[model samples]
Every structure is written in structure tokens, then in C-alpha cells.
Target: MSHDARVFLREFLRDPARVAAVAPSGRRLSQVLAGAVPRRGVALELGPGTGAVTDHIRHREPRRHLAVEVNPRLARLVARQWPDVEVVCADAAELGPVLDAWGAARVDAVVSSLPWALMPEAQQRTIMTAVQAALTDDGCFTTYAYVHALWMPPARRLPRLLRTAFTHVAVSPVVWANVPPAVVYRARAPRRDVRAD
Candidate 1:
């Protein structure tokens, strides 16, 4: 954590209304990334708060990855740490242009850590729509949500909507040894419609 990060984290902790604590464990990251990501293809990541998932992506090299972070401060940190990875400081909803600029016409997968439960329903739909548009026919987009009683409504509904965009949707539990256990939702891109010749 940088000096500035400490200050930001302190302030975040004070309220933490929007901040959900579901820090990715190295083991859990390996599991989800391995299962969801293809061996070699363009990958995209959203809301990489402190490079927890970013580190995993680096460790397991994809063909290339475009990581978009809304927070400029965190974006700088990720760029500095993973200089090889493409880092963009922008909203998740605005990923199309950035991905095109990065030469990612179609991504194979997107591993996200964007606190989805906290976002408004409309915002969630927008971001997921962007994700769907960016992915290849077989691409998968994976994200995690905190395990809590109150967050259930959105949590349950997200997977269903993901089905509309992706061909497959699966959720798995990852019990974090550190703080709170989380469930990772893996959604595969919708299959392309093929016509019989």
C-alpha cells in the first residue's frame, strides 16, 4: 500500500458504505482464473482495486489484458506495479473504446473485482452489457461478490441476467482465510448463432 493508499483506505474504512471487503486470496484467485480464463487469449479486468487480481493475471500470462480501473489513484498503482499490462483509468461502462485502442477486438475472458452488489441495477446492466460486447463468442467474464445476508437480492439476480449475455453461468464459493468468504460468478460468452449451410 502506498502512502496515499493508506490515507484513502482510512477514509474508506470510516464509512465503507460502498466499499465491500472481499479481498482475493492467492489460492482463490488461482482457482477462478485458471478455470475461467483460457490458456492464451486477450483478457480484460475491471475494478482492480489494489492489484490483487492483477497480480494473478500477471503470474498466469494471458495473450494480453486490458485492465480498466475507475479510480485514477489505483490505476496509477496498477500501472506502476504491472507495467506490461494495459491499464486504463476509466469507468467500466466505457470499456469499448479502450479495448479497441488496446487492439483487443474481442477478449477471451474478463476477470473482475468490481463490487457489483453495491452498484445500482441500471449501472450493473450497463457494465455487463459492455463486458458482453467486448468478449468473444466463447469468452468468459468472472467476478466475485461478498458473502452476506443483505446483499442476496442483487447477488442472486446478477447470474440470471448474465445468462442473457453469456451461454453459461456458474458460481462457486471461496472461503477466504483472511477476512470474509466470497462467491465467484463465472459467466461464459453467449454462443454465436450458426446457420446451417
Candidate 2:
């Protein structure tokens, strides 16, 4: 679980915007996200710093669990804590090759803990494209953003981007327990017929 806290603390100190939160996500937020998990199948987690949310996700009973952590230290921590999970030290934008390395054609669900508001538009577009391509026919992609930042131009544009990439997107109730609070985004891959348009 990397309960030591130093993992996230060090990362937060290194890059405030990248780390996003000062502390690991609280349990309430984790529960809210874990609840939205697919019934059963391979699930991918992005930026699982310290595996706080990953810990909660483990209980959701996914047949296969994979986590992509850009930081090697944090990735090692997650792998050590969750022996069954496949942890990769690579950028989320490289999901295609990473999934290929994992021998997964597509995943049923994707959960992200990335700081979308802080990313450049180009980087965001790249990662979003990778996410869309990595998902299976019935796959869904999920991520969260702080409620306070919802008004920011970049944050405001996130939902709009999701709508363009997915057939369905919905925002869940705010998890008040999280510092500064946050809301989850639940998005489903566009149906083949819908994508044809």
C-alpha cells in the first residue's frame, strides 16, 4: 500500500502540478472510483502514485490488474505491494506499447489519477487518444478532477474533450472527503456505430 507516505510526499515535492495532490487520495474518493469499476475484466490504472487508489481497486475483483506509473520508484512500490498487478514505469501516452508488452489486446476499464488540468493541450490530446485506443468494445475510461479547479478553462474543457472522444460521459458526485474535494468522470468507449459518424 506504500503507507509510508514518503513515496507521494517526495513526488509531490518534486512536481507539484504533476503530483496534483499534497497527500494520497483519501479512502472515500477511492471508494467512489472503485465503485465505478467494470464488473470483471482487465483494468488499467494510470499514474498510480504510491498505489493509494490502486489499493482500493484491488478489491474490485478484476480478472487482471495493470498499473502504469511514470515514476520508477512509485511503480516499484506498487509492484511490491500488489504482487498480482503488472506495474509499468512509462508515460500514460505510451499505453499502446505498454498494453502490447502486457499481452493485452484491450482492457475493459481504465482508471486514471493524472493531473489533466496541468497538462499541455497536446499532451492531453495524446494521452486521451491512447486511452481511447486502449479500451475494448465494452470498455470504459474513468478519471477525476478537483472540484475547485472545475471553473478553470483547462478543467472546463476536459469534459468537452471527453464528450468528443467517447459515446457517453458522466460526472459522479463530489467526494467531499478528498482534500479540496473532487469529482469522477465515467466515460464509455463510443459504440462502433456511433464512432462511424
Candidate 3:
């Protein structure tokens, strides 16, 4: 196995629920997720396992690249691999506070590799709420779901939650090159009333 896969597997073995995958995302899925990042402006990444997607995001050269990884080991690995990226060992659900601590007023894009399907509904809502609040008026959020999970309740619930939080949500074509395949969801235009209702 490759170094990235080994590292990812170690983490997965340590905490299956949090790591969610046996290996880091493939190059194709990484490219697709990073596509949402603007060429310039602040960009945030959640759960950058082994920095696979981080490589693609760096190529886009966003003004500021902030990555939040809940795992301390993975966070340190990403930080060492990409010294330029601001790596924070924090929960993605606490995005608002993370951004505030970083002094980022608003982010232009959010590329996430988090396992949304594994999260509870309340946790999903909490993370989405933070994402909606931290985004700029035109900022976009990108994340993926495994193809096999599309019919599952948690997968189905993600789009529903996103629709309620953002004005526009688009799902990309399935990336078959990825392990088990996956589809990326791009959401834009945060709804101001997301918290009111």
C-alpha cells in the first residue's frame, strides 16, 4: 500500500467512525472537490485526510487556505506536508469559531472531505449551520457522497439540509475512477434565514 493509504488506514483502524474510509480520496475525486475553490480569495477545507485534496486546492492558489481536521495525527501530517496551509485540529461543526479565530471574515469556497453520511442529523445541521454562516454571499461549498450511499437516508438528508441552507445546490456527475464512485455537491448563496427557522 502507498504511504497515504497506510496513514489513512491507521487512522481508520484507530477510529472507524471518524476516519470513515480505509484510504484517502483518489486523485479524480480530489480534483472534483477542489474545483469549487476560487483562484483567489479565502478557501476552507474540512477533513483533509493525508492532504490528497489539499494538493489540488494548493494548485488553485487561493489567497488563504485553511484546513480543519479533527484528528490530531492527520492534522499534524497535513500541516507538515503543506507548511503553507493553515491547519487546525478542530471539529468542522465549530467552523464559525475556527474561522473567527483565524480572523477570516468570510470564505470564498469550502472544499470538504468529511463523511457526512456517518454523522447524526443534529451534527450535520450544526456543521451546515456553521458553513452557511461563514460563507461569503457568493461562496460555494463542495463535498461528496459515495454512490452506494445515495439511496440511504443520511445521504438523502444531506441535500435536503443543503437546500434549506443555500439557494443553489448542484450535484456533479459520478466519478467512477474513485473507489466505489462518488458524487460531489456544490452549494452556493447561503440563506440568511437559515438560523431563524
Poorly placed runs, candidate 1 (over 4 Å): 1-8, 14-19, 22-26, 149-151, 176-178, 191-197
The residue pairs in collision within model 3 are none
Worst 10 residues of 2 by lDDT: 188-197
Candidate achieving higher lDDT, 1 or 3: 3
The TM-score measured for candidate 3 stands at: 0.97
Question: For model 2, how does the per-residue alpha-carbon lDDT over 1-197 read when each residue is reduced to its tens digit?
Answer: 45557667788899788788878888988777766567667889999898778988888888999999888888898899899998989988788789899998788888899988888777787788778777886788889999989988778878877887788999988888888699999988654433211
Candidate 1 TM-score over all chains jointly: 0.83
lDDT of 1 by residue, 93-146 (tens): 787778777877788888887777776777778777778877788778888766
Positional deviation of residue 195's Cα in model 1 after best superposition, in angstroms: 20
lDDT of 2: 0.82
In terms of lDDT, which candidate is stronger, 1 or 2?
Answer: 2
Top TM-score: which candidate number?
A: 3
* TM-score for predicted model 2 compared with the true structure: 0.91
Candidate 3 C-alpha lDDT tens digits along 1-197:
98889999999999999998887889999999998888977889999989999999999998999999999999999999999999999999888888889999689999988888998888899999888888899999999999998888878999999999999999999999998699999999999976512
Each model's lDDT:
0.70, 0.82, 0.91
Candidate number of the best lDDT: 3
Which clashing pairs does model 2 show? none
